[model samples]
Target: MQRRDILKLGLGMAAVAWAGGAGRTWAAASGGSVAAGADTLDAAAWNAARQWTRTAFGRIAHVERGGGPAALFLHGFPLNGFQWRGALERLSAHRRCIAPDMLGLGYTEVAEGQGVTPADQVRMLADLLDRLGVENVDLVANDSGGAVAQLFAVAHPARVRSLLLTNCDAEIDCPPPALKPVIDLAREGRFVSEWLAPWQADHALARSPQGLGGMTFTHPHNPSDEAIDMYLRPLVDNAARTHAYAIGLDSNVLAGVEAALKQGRYPTRILWGTGDDIFSKASPDYLAGVFGDSRGVRRIDGAKLFWPEEFPDLVAEEARRLWGV
Candidate 1:
């Protein structure tokens, strides 16, 4: 089948599945349809709703929905706020959902000579919340964003109401072996042009056996054409964005974070995808061990690194449970 046909079938099947299954689960819990809101926010709608906040780091681009205690969603490497669109769509009804494009990725503009390490991302988030008047937030993150979430939780325990982590960099396996090739490319400042540009240019390549779909997503044509453009265009468009992108993956920024995380008694839960190749399978158990108040770990069988996007229903269900909403 052609890629466009696959996307059409996927969309139709997804709508049916959500309406029949997850919608019922959500209705049982909250007395409402999970598909109630403006379903999926495509590139145009997402861009229309985009807002910016100026900070010391740079102009931070973010999108928000709903109205209540804040819930912050973080994306993985080479992706942006768009990664959490599915989650934000479902959970926005329960909490004020915010998804920000981290510095060096997406639309977040970095200041001249600024760093985009995990540590730096943590500080940027704090500043962002402060500017937005969000005193605290329920944190949800996947992939590299998970590393930033961990650091943020430890650094500002009082500012984090709860934590939900997906497959990401852990202290025990900081900068896991799987990232070596990507890291090498980043180190040489060729990652964006050499890797992401092609995926952005060709959606089929992105969903092929050798691309993001084969590696991270469970479904072929998972990210869609609009998603591919929105997620990768910025990284490949400018020299500054590319430089910041490479800087973020240059080193093990998660070093020394474990000792700090273990001391915190914050409410935490781990959701790990067993099929992920980028992170260690033992990471969830390792993270559960480190957190003083770990609720538990939920292993998602056959799911890959980007399962949160693929399985937003599960993400929202677990997030609601963790937030006690």
Candidate 2:
């Protein structure tokens, strides 16, 4: 079957199953207290949604809100800020949450014929923050965002109040064995699509039959069709895939992070998902060792790289505790 057809079928099945019996169970599993999609701050909730112009970096589509201290959410590569829907719902209640579609991802337009680099992406983020009138912020980042956040913190220490990382790759002397091959492939500018295709296909297949085993904290009783649709939407196009490859090939994110830690400017905290297959638990340990006595590392049980989706409440609770929001 074609990719789109397969996604449609998966989404249809997911919707029907979710609408029937699994809806209540899914909600309960996520944390009975909070409502699904209740806390998300979208274009509808914000006063205005605008595209931020950063001369060297290009335009970044972002949303802004007024209130408490600024909290900027930097999303992982391949996925857009939509991944933060669950976390945003809880966070938006107190602080103003700024979730932007990074360069070459989501609604943000990428520069034609130019591959997005880690340095350029970080610069765009800096520009986005400045354009929004945010002086300093509590940084929340995941996956590739961790590297960008680290660089931002190092470059602009005064602009960051605290750091919260989830399933991210931080600068450590000894990196995980699992990532070595992928990192090497990325560095070589090889066929990252072919390298990542198997895992991506497996993830798609896992949504059915065998189920979300080992992928999510709890078995998804009723995974939202819309959620699945949103997740798969980006992959349907070449622009998204090309950017994903660009991010994979960029080695500076890792190297830049290492350089930043050596600078010793900002305080950092790491929240890792033990079940994350992308970046192994060893990555966090390596980060802890690099930070030495100053930094903190905490592990989340029954969660994977995509912890926000698998255990939204747990992520929110942990962020709240760490950031004191």
Candidate 3:
């Protein structure tokens, strides 16, 4: 069949599957989503060392220090908790920062039967928080993590003290068109994982100077080899790829969060990287419409999608101002 026809059939099957409640089970059972490993922290010496915790849900890795209230960082797709390396270091000065590699990303152990869907990941996060003895937190989320953060905040509003979002798709109508094929292939458990593995590697490499001009949105110094390796570890591993794909396919959390927001209000803020090639800055307008009209909106322009890395100080300052840390 033509690729477009296959996609059409996939969409139909997905709709029926969702209606039949099969999608939920599929998410729950796609276990061992994140792989297990040692801390992937950069070699920078620190005032206090970062720590790792193995949770009932998966790996609960984070950097902690002198504390105010807790600030939890959630990384985006195809990236791990390490994505927040710069921000975590800065935030640790004022708040206890916990950054976890979502179920299928980073060095976290992939759970059995757990698909990478946002709902499943959010539940896993709740479980992880419980294990960590955290009651409530300020959440900073970027890219795909934004949707996960939204679901968490809506389902357990009291658990979220405040929210800070970067370039991420929060509405069903606004998801990047490029993601559809990836979602369909993931649902089918086909060679889609293999097909995308190289791309994942390419993206990681692109972060480097040599790779940056070729693949990234802007040119800067080449990213260290360690940085590239750390990013690619999860993608090259088959188990991690499976979980990542599953998560991508099951990302209905955006729709769910939007529906919930219509019922009530939450304190939210938006920061976007204008250079983001994946999800653009315009994506946050959905949140702006939902939360801005009443509570007011705050934006930090020119921060890339990986704002935590590109503009760590700005993220730290905005988060502190928002959280009153």
For model 3, residues 1-325, the per-residue Cα lDDT tens digits are 2444332221100000011122122223332111123222332322124456776665555545446677889877556666675666567667778888777666666656656677777888888788778898888997678878877877887788788887777675345554565556565664334443443466543443223222222234334444555555555676545546454644444665655665544567777666555564456676766752223445555434454555566777888888766
> Which ten-residue region of model 1 has the weakest summed lDDT?
8-17
lDDT-wise, the better of 1 and 2 is 1
Maximum-lDDT candidate:
1
**Segments of candidate 2 deviating more than 4 angstroms:** 1-56, 64-66, 173-223, 240-252, 256-259, 262-265, 292-295
Worst 10 residues of 3 by lDDT: 11-20
User: Each model's RMSD to truth, in Å?
Assistant: 6.5, 7.7, 11.7
| lDDT digits (tens) for residues 124-215 of candidate 2 | 77877777787899888887777777777777777887787777766542133434443454455442354333334455444552332224
- The C-alpha lDDT values of all candidates are 0.76, 0.56, 0.57
Give the lDDT of residue 55 in candidate 1.
Answer: 98
- lDDT of model 3 at position 260: 66
Question: What order do candidates take by lDDT, descending?
Answer: 1, 3, 2
- lDDT computed for candidate 1: 0.76
